[model samples]
Target: MILFKAALATGVLTVGLSASQAAYAAPLSASIQSAATDPRANVKIDSKIQVERTEESASGEITTTLLDPATIKVIPGDKLLFTNAYRNTGGSAVTGFVVNNPVHPAVALTEVLEDWALVSVDGGKSFGKLSDLSVSETASESAPTSRPAQASDVTHIRWVLASPIAPGASGELQFRGIVR
Candidate 1:
C-alpha cells in the first residue's frame, strides 16, 4: 500500500489506504517509490532524480549535463524535472496502478510527461484543465466570483496506468514544476 501526504493552502491532504486497510486489502501488493531532490536506495526500492543543465563551452558551444538533483538549490522561477520510478517487487502482477502527487503550495505545475494524467486545482476535489477550473474569489463580503485558474492554482496531479505491471517489471512517471 502507498500513502501520500501533502500540505495545501487550506490544510494537509492525505490519500491512499491506511495500515489497517492494507492488512485487509487485496492479495496482490505493489510498492510506489519517489525521490524529492535526491536519490535513495534500499532493499525494497531505489529512486533518484536526474537534473538537466545546459552550459556554454569556451568555444561558445552549448552542451547539456545531467546531474544529481541534490546538488542544486531551488529558487523562485526555477523549473524542476522529476521522474518517479516504480518497481514491482511482488510475486504477482499488479493492476490498476495509480500515482498521485500534490504540488507544493509554494510552487506550481507547469508540465507533465503523461498527457492522460488529470490535474486538480481545487485542492484535489476535481481534476481538469485550468481554463475548465475555477475558484471562489471572495475579495469582499458582498458576493463570491469565479475566475479562471492560473498555473499557480494547480494543486494536485494524478496518473493512472493503462496496463498492468508485471512481476519484476518497472515503470516511470515524469513531470515538471516551476517555483512560485
Candidate 2:
C-alpha cells in the first residue's frame, strides 16, 4: 500500500489507500495553507522527512544516523522522522498558534510528546489520548460499541501553542512512525 503522510505547522493530514482517494486530494492543499495561516502573524513553516539508523563507533559508542529526505527510499519496517519548524517573522507576538501532522496509514505512531500534542484516530474529526479514543469494529454497531485505539489507528497529530510566539522566535515539533 502507498500511504502519504503530511504535516502542517498548524495540523497534520494523512491519506490512506482506499476507494475514496478522490475526496482526499482537494483538501490537502487547503489544509497545508490553513496550517500556516496567521493573517497578521508572519510565521514560516518548513518540514522534512528523515530515515533513522543506528551505528556503533570503534569505541563502542552508539550513534544515530538521520538520512536526508532526498536520499531515502522508505520501505516497510523503516522508521521515518517528520520535522516541522516554525519561525515568527512578524514584529509582534503570535498567539493561539497550532500545528498538526498526519500519520501515514500504512505506518503506526510509535512515540510522541504526550504533553505537547493530542492525537486523532478518526480522520482528524476528534482527538485525545489513544486510551481515551475508540473505533467501531462493526459497521452496523451503534451506541459506543467500539474498541480502544491503537498506534496504527492514529490519523492525525495536533499541537496548540500554550503561549504566544514572540517575534524572531522559532520552535519545532517532531513525530516518528514506522513504515508498514
What tens digits encode model 2's per-residue C-alpha lDDT throughout 29-139? 213232245432366666666668778999999999987534444456777677777788877787777666777666688877546578998898887877788887865
Candidate-wise lDDT, in order: 0.57, 0.64
Superpose all Cα atoms of candidate 2 onto the true structure and report the RMSD in Å to 1 decimal. 7.9
Backbone clash tally (model 2) = 8
Worst 10 residues of 1 by lDDT: 36-45
Candidate 2, residue 134: the lDDT equals 85
C-alpha TM-scores of all predictions: 0.66, 0.72
Off by over 4 Å in 1: 1-51, 129-131
| Residue-wise C-alpha lDDT for candidate 1, range 56-171, written one tens digit per residue | 99999999876553444434555556566777666566666666667767556778788787788887888876567777799789987888887677788777667767777887
Q: Cα lDDT for residue 32, model 1? A: 39
